[model samples]
Target: MHDFDWIYECAVIFYVVSLLGYFIDFLQNNRKANRFAFWLLSIVWVLQIIYFFVTLMQINRFPILTPYEGLYFVSWLIVTLSLLINWFSRIDFFVFFANIIGFIMMSVYVFSPETELLPFITETMTTELFFMHIAMAFLAYAAFTLAFVFSLMYFIQYEILKNKINFRRLGRFGSLPELEKMSLFFTMIGVPLLLISLIWGAIWGHLTLDTFFYFDAKVVTSIIVLMMYSFLLYMKIMKQEHGKKLALINIAAYLFLLINIFLSQSFSTFHWW
Candidate 1:
C-alpha cells in the first residue's frame, strides 16, 4: 500500500459525496446543495494537489505514466475546470456535466490496479526544463479545454435559440457574443502556451536524448494541432468569421486535438503516456 493510500480514499469519498450533491442540485435547482458540492469539490482538489505533490517529491520525477495516475489527473483537471467555469461564467448545468465526467474517471481509477512509475523514466537525466515543458503543456491543455467548453456553450445556446426552447434556466448560459469572445480569448491564450511548451520540450529533448527529431509522432501531432488552432484563429480574426459556423469549426478543431492526444500516446517514442 502507498503511504498516501488513506488520502486517496478520502479524496474518493469526497468526490462521491460532491457528485451526489451536484446531482441533487441538478434535479431540484437547489443553490444550497450546489454551494455545498462546490466546497466539497474544492476540498477534493486540495487533497489531490497534496497527494500529487507528495508523490512527485517521493518519486523525484513526473509520475504520470500509469492508468491510475492518468485517470486521477484527468479527474482533477475536470474539477478544476468546472470550478473555474462556475466562478467565471453563468453557464447552467455545466458543473453538473463536468462533475459527472470527473466522477466516471475517478470510479475507473478506483477499480484499476495500483501501479508505480516506470523505473527507466524516473532514472532518466531529467532537468528543470523538462518539468517546465510538462507544466506548460498541461497549462496549454487546460486553456484549450476552456475554449472548447465555451465553444460548446455557444452551440447549445444557438440550438436553444433556434429551436425556441423556452426553459427559463437556459438563459444562464452566456449570450453567443460572450461565449464566442471567451472561446477566442482562451484559444489565443492556449496557442502561445502550446508554442512555449513545444520550444521547451525541444530544448529538453536536445539536452537529454541522443537523437531528437521534430518528426516524432508526438511532436508532429502537436505541431499539427497547433496549426489547426492557428488556422481557426486566423479564420475568425483575420477573415472576420463569426457565429455558429465558426463555433462548429472550433469544436471540430478541439475534437482533432483530442484525437492527437490518443494518437500520439499510441505511437510516441519518448512520451510517457
Candidate 2:
C-alpha cells in the first residue's frame, strides 16, 4: 500500500482507540481516560490532515467529488467541532457522540467502493461558485448536525429535570441551560451558512445552466429546511420561545433536513450526489 494509505489506516485505528478512551471516560468519569481521548484524537486529526494533503496533491483538486471523500470531510468537520467545544467549555460529552459519528463516517469511507478520480476540473464542477456552494452546504450540514445533537441532549436533560431524576449517574452530559445555549449557537451559525450556500448554488446554476432558479425537489426541500430553521431561530430570539417547544422544533427541522438530503438525489435534477 502507498504511504498515504498507510497513514489513513493508522488514523482510523487511532480514532477507534480515542473513541474507546472517551467511552471509558463516560462510563467511569475518569479524568485520565478523558485526557487520553483528547490526546489520541489530536493525533488522529494530525494524521488525517497529512493524509488529506497527500491525497489533494495526488488528485490536484479538492477531494470532495466522491462519496468517500465527502464522508472524510464530514468526519473531519465533526471532529474539529468536537475539539473546539471541548477546548472552550471543557465539555467532553459532545466529543463522545461526535466521535461516534466520525467513526461511522470513516468506516463508511474505508469500506465504500472506490471510483476512479475524474480529471482535475470537470466542466460542470470546475467553477468557483460550485466549489463555494459545496463547501458552504456541507459546512451548514455539519453545523445543523451539531445542533441536532445538542437538541437531543436538551430533550434528555429536560426529561430528567421534569422527573426530578438524579443526574449524577448520567455521566458528563451538560445541564439543560448549557445544552440550550449550544443548540442555539449552532442553529444561529447554520442558518446563515445554509442561506449562503443556496445563494451560491443559484449563482452557479445561473452561470452554468442559464437558469437562475428551478423549482426542483432539492431546491424546494432546501428552502423548506432553511425556512424551518429560520422560524425556529426567530421564535427563539424574537419571541423568547424556550424549553420543550424549541427543542422539539430543532429536532424536527434537523430530521427534515436529513430526509431531504437523503432523498434529494433521487428526485432532484441539479444534485446527483
Candidate 3:
C-alpha cells in the first residue's frame, strides 16, 4: 500500500497553502494570489492522483469504495477543472470559494481515517461503464459547485450595488455581467453532465437491483437535485430570469444537492458513497 499517512499529510499542507493564497486573493485583490493558489491546488491534485493509483494497486481495486475517498477525488477534480477553466477564461475570481470548499473537503478526508479496500459489491460493479458513470457524476457535481461559488459572489456584489455601498472589495471584481456569464457557463455544462449521470445511474441501478426498479433514497434525492437544475435551465431558456435571480437559483440548487447527498450518504441503505 502507498503511505496513506504521508500522502494525506502532504495533501493537507498543500490545501492549506492553496486556501491561504485564495483567501489572500479575495481580500488583497491580488491576481498573483490566484496564480499561486491554482499552482498549489494543481500540485496537490497531481499528488492525490499518484496516491490514488498507488492505493488502487495496493487494494487491487478502484479507490472509491468509501465516501471519503470518493468525495476527496471529486474535490480534487473540481480544483483541477477550475484551474483549467480559469487559465482559458482568465477569470480568477472564482478561485476564492473554490479553494475554500476544496480545503474543507480535504480536511474532512484527512480527519476521517479509513481503509481503501473495496467491498465485494463495489468490486463487482467496478466495470468500465461504472467508472465512466461515476466520473461524469462527480465532475458534474464539481461544476455545479463552482457555479454555486460564482453565484454567491454575484449575489454578494449585487447586494452591495443595491444598497449603494462603496466597498473596496467589491471594486476589485469585474462587471456583474462578466461574473454572471461565467457562472451561467459553468451551470450549462454541469446540467447536461448531470442528466447523463442520472441516465447512467438508472442503467447501473437496474443492472444491480435485480428484484425492484423503484426509488431508493439516493435515487430519489438525486432526481430531486436534477429537477432543481432542470427548473433553472427551463427558466434560463425561457428568458424569464437573468443576472441575480439566475445566480440565486444556482446557489439554491447546489445547496439542496449538498444536503441531499450528505443525508442520503448518512442514512440510506444502499448508498455507494
Candidate 4:
C-alpha cells in the first residue's frame, strides 16, 4: 500500500510537469519543450505499467473489476492515447486535455482509498467531493485566467499590427495565431473542468438545499460564464472564426467569471451559512 502511494505520488508529479511542458509548447510552438514533456509522459506511462503489474500480482487477478481500479486503468489508457498522439501528430492540445483527464482520474483513485479505509473518512467522502468540486472550479478559473492573458496579448498584438507599428519585441511573445490558439487551448481546458465543477456543485446543492433558486447570483453568473465560453468554443469549431472577435469573447467571459467569483462569497438567504 505504501509502495502504491509512493508510485502514484511520483507519477502525479511527473504528470503535472509533463502537462506544463505541453502547455508551454502549445503556447510557444517550442519543439524542444514538447520533446521534454513527451519523455516525461513516457516515464509516467512506464510508472503506471509498473504499478498495474505490481497490484495485479498482489491481488492475483486483473485490477479492472472495481471502480478505483477502473479509474486507474482509464487513466493509463488516456496517457497511452495522449503519448501516441504526441508521437504521431501536431495535436499537442489534445494531449494537454487528455492528460488533464488522466491526472483527474489518478487523483480520484488516490484519494478514494482513504475515504474507504476509515469510517469517519467514508462518511465525509461526499463532503470531500464537494470540496473537489470547488477546487476544480478554481482550477477552471485559473485556466481561463491564462486564456485571458493570452487573449489580451493577442488583442495587443493585433492592435500593433493594425497600426502598422513593427515592435520587434512583440514577436518574442508569440505570433497572433499562436497567441489566439493558446488562448483557445487554455479555454478548451477550462470549459469541461468548469462544467464538471458546476455539475458537482449542482448535485451538492440539490441534496442540501431545502429550496433551490435558479436566480441565485452565484448560480446565474456561473451558468452565464459557462454558456459564454461554450459559445466561444462553438464559434471556433463551427463558425471557424478567428482574430479579435474570439479573443474579445474569451476576455469578456473571464471578466464575468471573476465577477462571479468575488460576488459569490455573499450569503443569500437560500444559501448555507
Candidate 5:
C-alpha cells in the first residue's frame, strides 16, 4: 500500500511536468514542445497502469468503489484514451483539453489539504457490479470533461467571430469545424456510457441496504443531466444540428454534468478525493 502511494506521488510529479510542457506548447504553438508533452503524458499513463495493478495486488480486489480511487482511475483512463485517439488520428486537437483536465484533477489531488484514502467507502458500500458501474460513470464524465473544454474553446472562438475580435492565437488552433466534430464525437461516446452507468447504479442501489427510490439529490440531478444530454443528442441526430449550435449544447451538457458530480459528492458520505 505504501508502494502504491509512492507510485501515485510519482504520477503527480509526471502530471505536473506534463502540464507545464502542454502549457508551453499551447502558448508558443510549438510542435516539438507538444511532442515532448505527449511523451511525458504517455509515461505518466504507463506508470498509472502499473499503479493500478499494484493497487490490485495490495487490496487483492478491484479499486473502483472508493471515489478517490475511482476518480483517479477515471482521470487516467481519460488521458490514456485521449492519447490513443491522438495517436491514431494524428490530431493534436484533444491534447490541450486533455492536459487542462488532467492537470486540474492532479492539482486537486496534490494540493488539497486532505489526501487520505477511505477504507469504508469500499468495505461498506461496494459491490462488484457497483464498482464497475461507478468506473463507467467516472470514465464517461472524464471524457465529457475533455469535450467540455473543447466546446468552450469553440464557443469562445465563435464569440470572437461574432464580435469581429482580432485574436490571432485562436486562429492558430484547429478550425471550428474540426473542434466541433471532435467535441461532438466525444459527447456521442459519453452519453451511452453514462446511460448504462445510470441503469447499473439503480440496480446496485436496490441491492444495497438503501431504499430503492432513495434517489439522492445527486442521482436526481444526474438523471436530469442525462435527459438534457439526450435531448441534445436528439437534436443532433433527428434535427441534424451541428457546428456552433451543437458545440454550445455540448458545453451546456458538460456544465450540468460537472454540477451534478460536485453535488453528488456533497451527498456522498464517502470520500470523493
Candidate 6:
C-alpha cells in the first residue's frame, strides 16, 4: 500500500507538470508546450494505470468503492478521455479545459482521506453488476465534466462575440460553433451513459437488496440530474435551442451534480463514503 501511494504521488506530480505545459500552450500558443503536455500526460496516465492495478490487487477488488478511490478513478477517466479527444479532434482548447478539471480533481484527491483495504468485502459490492454500475456512473460524470467545460467555453466565446470584444485576442479559444458542437456532443454521450448506469444500479439494488429503488437522496438527485440533462438534449433537438440558453442549462445541471456529489454522502445511506 505504501508503494502504491508513492506511485500515485509521482503520477500527481507528473500531472501537475503536464498542466503547466498546457497552461503555457494556452497563454502563448506554443507547439512545443502542447507536445510536452501530451507526452507528460501520457506518462501520467501510464503511471496511474499502474497505481490503479496495484491498489486493486491490494484491496482484492475494484478501487472505486470509496470516495477517495472514486475521485482518483474519475480523474484518470478525465485524463484518458482528454487524450483520446486530443488524438482524434486535435482540439487543444478542449484538452486544456479537461485537464484543468483533472488537475483540480487530482489535487483534491491528494488531500482526501487515505484509501485502505476494507476489513471485509460485502457480497453486494462484489458482484459484477455493482461494479459496472459504479464504473459507468463515474464515466458518465467524467463526460459531464467535459460537457461543462465546453459549455463554459461556449458562453465565454458567446459573450465575447455579443459584446463585440476583440476577436483577435480570443482567437485561440476556438470558434463559437466548434465549442457548441463539442458541448452538445458530450451531453449526448453522457446522458445515455448515465441512463444505462442508473438502469444497472437499479438492477443491482433489486438483486442484492430486494429493492428496485431506495428513494435515497443520492438516488433522487441522480434521477433529477438525468432528467435535467435529458431536458437539455430535448430542448436542443426538438425546440431547436442553441447558444447561451443551452450552455447555461448545462452549467446549471453540472453545478447541481456537484452539489449532489458533495452533499449526498452525508444524507444518503446507499452512496455514503
Best by lDDT: 6
Rate residue 169 of model 4 by lDDT.
49
lDDT of 5 by residue, 55-146 (tens): 78877777665445666666787788778877876445467666677666655554544334457655645577777678778878876877
**Better-scoring candidate (lDDT), 1 or 2:** 2
Cα lDDT tens digits, model 1, 1-273, are 677778878998998898889888767778898899989999999998988898889776665545356567767787888898788777656677657757876777778876665556655534578767766666677677767778887898899889999766666666789889988988999899899989988988888888897788889989988998899899898999999987888888878877766567788787765
The TM-score-based order of candidates, best leading, equals: 6, 2, 3, 1, 5, 4
User: What does the lDDT come to for candidate 2?
Assistant: 0.84
lDDT by residue for model 3 (1-273), tens: 245769867877887888788888877877788778878888888888877787778777776656687678777877787778667765566666676787777678777866544567766568776676777778888888888887888898899999999777675555788788877788888888988987887777667766533467777888888898888888888876888888888998998888876777675666657
Alpha-carbon RMSD of each model: 2.7, 2.1, 2.3, 8.8, 2.9, 1.9
Local accuracy by lDDT, each model? 0.79, 0.84, 0.77, 0.74, 0.73, 0.84
Worst 10 residues of 6 by lDDT: 115-124
Give the backbone clash total of model 3: 0
Backbone clash total, candidate 2: 0
Residue 39's lDDT in candidate 2: 93
Q: Compute each candidate's TM-score over C-alphas.
A: 0.86, 0.92, 0.89, 0.54, 0.86, 0.93
1-273 per-residue lDDT for model 4 (tens digits): 555768778888999899899889767778798789889999999999998898778655555433466567757876775577456644345566557757886887888753122444233333655666655665676577667767877887799989999665455456788778878988999999999988988887787666777788788888999999999999999999999999999989978986775556373444321
RMSD of 4: 8.8
Poorest stretch of ten by lDDT in candidate 1? 117-126
Instruction: List the candidate numbers ranked by lDDT, top first.
Output: 6, 2, 1, 3, 4, 5
* Leading candidate by TM-score: 6
Runs in model 5 lying further than 4 Å from the true structure: 90-93, 111-124, 164-172, 268-273
